[model samples]
Target: MSFTTRPEITGTFGVATSTHWIASAVGMRILEQGGNAFDAAAAMGFVLHVVEPHLNGPLGDMPLLMRKAGDAAPTVICGQGPAPAGATIAHYKAEGLTLVPGSGLLASVVPGAFGAWMLLLRDHGSLPLRAILEPAIHYARHGHPVLPRVAHTIAGLAEFFETEWPTSFATWLPGGKAPAPGSLFANPDLADTWERVLAEAEVAPDRAGQMEAARLAFYEGFIADAIDTYLRDACVMDAAGGRRKGVMTGQDLADWQATYEDPLSVDYHGWTVWKCGAWTQGPTLLQSLRTLSGIDLGAMDLNGAEFVHTVTEAMKLSFADREAYYGDPLHADLPVSTLLSAEYAEARRKLIGATASRAQRPGHIAGLERWAEAAVARAGRDLAAGPGVGAGEPTMAHLTERRGDTVHIDVIDRWGNSVSATPSGGWLQSSPVVPGLGMPLNSRAQMFWLEEGFPTSLAPGRRPRTTLSPSMAEGPDGRQLAFGTPGGDQQDQWQLILFLRLVHGRMNLQQGIDAPLFHTAHFQSSFYPRATKPGHLMAEPAFGEDVLRDLRDRGHEVEVAEPWTVGRLTAAQRDADGLLRAAATPRLMQAYAAGR
Candidate 1:
């Protein structure tokens, strides 16, 4: 066995893992109180919104993959909100943006996460909405220890908020200064927001009625009213280096609701991996697995140069396809069947050469090549001069930026139910906070394209092709797992590596998560500015000199990153013997796992 920073948590009763220790503990607390996995996850989800405000918030997007006890298949709860009716390509262009700004009002989307959590609590969870929200309410009203990174992020943005967004200034700089790290930071407004929702919910006689009432409170009542009223009059500086008013209206908020959908899956080796459909970047991992299925990865050294090269090359090809084909399937004719076929993988696999390729080589789908070619051309020209500045999604950074990505949670209950969710979008830096709500609307609209030709083009009521991807899989040996990470485009790349290590290398959860990680930046970023770096591959320095040298020899633009800074992944698993296992990456020192 290899040295791991922590033991793989094993329990027969329940397990919950999340990017924040407080959220993980909340979930376990719920489970200890006999709440099922869905109930525990809902509780933990709310806690994450309060405790990890820099990483995620109530206004962000979340896609959940869940399985009921004894069910063979997992279903997706799509919390990703759609573009508002006023969010058209023409309006953005009229606002002088060729791309959506990374921050401010114009980039805001209908807040979906609040309603989504309510949905989970309503349909799948057993606890009352009040019970599910208690931990978050307490944390928000009283206080929680502020993460140092959160403090740093706030400090960096203090000037921006004070100068351009006074509402944000009041919320973040309570005393005209950023909250000190380790200080008890409270958002009494956020707590009041939840309390109001709970108050509205209590008027209902039962759990189902209460859940619906809470949803209404967020989407139709005071929350929506405050967001709409605030946005209508407010215009602030955006990524285009200009100030702009938002296009979303109260009608948009009232019109949107979280929906459940069938999950997309692909069989690899002996296990079946599942992800949210094309609407999210989840399918990118599935496509990478398909491409890798044709390769004999077992024969390669798990941490050696060849393995890294092959995996990175495969991901490049898959993400290239992602740029070309994947989108909101509701709006686009995504040839998912052809894309996932073995023959197509074989054809795409040939593009993986001995050296790294600089081109964004999207495959030629016979009937869809015109669309594919157009997307490829646009991708090539779409490269941002550099990363988007200011508040944006939980983004991947080397050591330069203090910006973090998203938050992830995986929960498995004693009853055998499981859920994996990636929640992101609303960050303190992303947009100005709604005055009364103490949370900013998500900037997920930045994921949409301003140009009119692609499936991801900004359209009324269409979901942005989100990068918030969660994962679930069933191993051949009857081990079921839920895992995900928080790098914008790197979510799947990190997940694929961990899964391969778990299934093929026979590594336990911690071992797999702790393994050195790497990802390519050859494709356009999903966030605003949409930067791309041809042949770029970032690896943890712990991967050592030989692996780095081999990758460099293969023509990769290799950059060594600080150790334990690449992937923030967390996972929970249940084995055939009914034993539960959980692990979280030690990379960020923020993630934690708790169980028996």
Candidate 2:
């Protein structure tokens, strides 16, 4: 029933990913060639935009956090854009808005990738921006396989081909059509942007200037003005708005701007973790992980009833916090101080059972009595599922979820330093195109609370809480580990479970990442809904009633998940001798790790 936590090995390790394994290989080469972790990670983060445009783009938001071995202080950066100060919650209310098309388009925030990446390089990277960007530039110009995931998403959104702003896809396509998987694709416009970023980095070589150029090229240039005109002219968004109708006006493009800033995070059970601040649901991940820690997770097998019950109860406890206090930390007085406190962790842990899990959370923390009451009031009720529900028909149950635009790259070098990063190309599927620019305007403005006066409502310069969290963990023995995922809300538990599997079960990086995973949406704010209820677990349907019985004894809802239900992307442990291993969920196609 007990699993032992093993010590982490030492050596250079790196994990970087593009939608394609080629980019992943490129980063591994950099690491082996003696580039630091940041350089390796930056290479992967930039190139994914070229190979996986439909999922992520240069136009979207980025949230990044990192820590070095034995370093008490951790640095955090936000890669997400902000709502224009002009975009108030009042805007949605005034317009009688029911929904916004893409979360990236809804974004009023300024894009922060330029600044965030520089900060990473400035502190952790060894090579110059020029050196780090070389790989991406090559990939952008030369091209790689049209991943099935990428091709499918773009084909589904073919309307984008006709949108007001020029799509870079056409440039990559050459024949003016999507290339089939395995066909070569290239991005000339992004190549130009890549050149500009490199030129800026060469000229100023400072974080502020280099990053600002990256921002300005997309926002204030011919691209931005045209898109502004289009949005103003069109009023409504669709493919024809650009090429056929000429509807979106330059004025609308002018109105569009990417947001930027350092998003907030908190410690759960004394370990540093990241969240998607105000606009997106990031804190819910932190709260659930902390709550889960209180239970005796090893009481049953990984898929057994007891394990499921304890996990779900903890999820319910944390859900209360997410629903109540999980908003932009700056906009409100979240009880984060108390939520992560030892007293609350212990209190939250006490409500679980080895037999049957409760379908709800307990008001264990004193300050959260109000939240507890609310949960009690709403007990047995299900929080509404967000957009993109019932999208499992496509490959990997990700038709909606896999419209992915975020990328994660983590690196640890032989020098005992590590870097964790998550970057974005604005959501290609939903963001509007400015007339001249090939990039899409971020639509994260939609992540704001649709209702009036919600804590996450848009305001001047306020950052949207996002699911784009990049995190690093250090073992109790000073051995270091870092990882992040693209699964929206599952980023938290998915990464947490992976970390625990390696530490608690002593699995290697691949085995740990490849292992079956379970989660409970009950009472928790998931990027996806359809939470597990009492007596259910989203597990491989291989375990027997004995496992379920044990979970019931602990008050869990253990449901059978299709085997291989989850595996978010990961970049960790730099060298094989070290922990630098890349682990994509086995469920995902063509995901693997490479290190030298």
Candidate 3:
């Protein structure tokens, strides 16, 4: 079965992430309804919040970067949530909690994706907030089928269902079990919450008003109170959450506001890359691109050994800098200007070679700061066989977890304008809702450092650094593409590799997205406390045994993964002959490219 290379998906382009085909279909519908990319994206993002609660919710933070055709620079909408004023590292240690939480609880970060959606609508949108958000609201109320990814993630961690923690077995493991795909899953409470969004939109039908309604209903109103009460009961609400940690008093929610500011961006090889400022690690993307400057990566084929090897090494340099100097610039004094500086990139690029790197070096170029020397590494990494990270066994273990994929949409109007974004409440992996008020607080707050004085340490109104970076690139001759992925830390590696494949390797978008994929495993998990090693490669088996043997010869530790399986998700768009063409990664279920 071959997908024809056609450039007909125009007028609007949208992609829904994950195994939830219906939700992705909802996003495609917005474009079909004549909505622009932003509207489609906003709509798609809302659907994810409703159906993909395990990814994130009203509570998780969202750090976004975007650029349109006419804008001189991308606007930075810092949607990520801030730590409650009262949260502190001392509190976690005192409580005897591990503090380094994984996908579940303790993986909390500040959530702001929903607010970002409203912000985009206010800045540039033709559709009403109700229209844009209606799809998600309707779906949450009517119910949607369980996705394969959701079913598998849940089953893998059956212990979580058994835990007496705040997210008791009964809450997530309803019927004391994980829901399988094809099963009808419904959440009336979520339906009620989405309905409230419409109610608020009517109250202030304008953009700001719509946002106000959403912010008030989700953060300040009844939902806030319920979340506060839940946190208090769980004993995790330290001082950083707020002055009124108990039931999050009225004063706390009332103070919430959706904000926007000029995001920091740098020009690399004619493309403009933006990053969110001071509060989060938005600058890292720029730094990464900068580090790749003048590397002559075009000499290698996309996803080919040489190309993958060179880019991965370059990314490692950027990530090392990420660990050392990337953080809340407000407190840690990051070297953003210096890192993205032409001279600095020149220096960093020299450290990488066309040959594979044997091991990672410290981020001395970015300065000497580090996050506990030698404590960061990616998991299940093996350098052998190109890029793979599995033992090459087909786990007949059925996919059994249930969670919503991400929501992403990008648009280019006939007027030559554009909008690209991924709005998210997040997957449903967090603890169950606050009950009556509607929506779940982001359990992502726990992603921050539990140690005192760290740049990512918990603090009043401080945002956590994240890998959810929105990106864009332009050709020296004016050809361009704007794309991104929805897989947390994997977002960077996936987008980076895809871009290299499409532009540098000269492959079409589909070929770029479908080319064999691999991610370097040596780094600190931005979301967890796992150390991924340098030689580890999480890759598909289609490349064959010789490829794996070659990688092994080069000192790789290979882990063979099932083809078309992995957490990475990608999307793309390019304008040609007065129409915009797009493609979605078919590697995973439900990734579709639709427009017109």
Best by lDDT: 1
Ranking by TM-score: 1, 3, 2
lDDT of 1 by residue, 1-596 (tens): 77998999999999999999999999999999888999998899889888888888898889989899899999899999999999988888887778888877878788788778888888888888888989999999999999888888888878777888888889888889888989999998899998989999999999989999998888888888998898788888876678789988888989988988999899998899999999898888888898888889999998889999999999988888888788898888888988888899999888889999898888898777776787677767845522334554533545323353689999999989999999988888788889899898888888888878788888998899889899999998898999998888989999999999987899999999888888888788787677788999999888899889999999999988887788888999999899999999887688999998
Q: Model 3 over residues 376-421: C-alpha lDDT tens digits? A: 3322333122110111101111112333334444444444455556
Candidate 3 error regions (>4 Å): 1-20, 32-34, 103-110, 154-178, 205-207, 235-253, 266-269, 275-285, 353-359, 365-407, 423-426, 574-577
lDDT of 2 by residue, 469-539 (tens): 66665554444556776655555656666755565556666666665566554543322222334444455
User: Taking the candidates one at a time, how many backbone clashes does each contain?
Assistant: 1, 100, 79
Cα error of candidate 1 at position 247, Å: 0.8
Candidate 2 positional error at 528, Å: 9.7
Which whole-number lDDT from 0 to 100 does residue 540 have in model 3?
66
Better of 1 and 3 by TM-score: 1
Residue 6 displacement (Å), model 2: 20
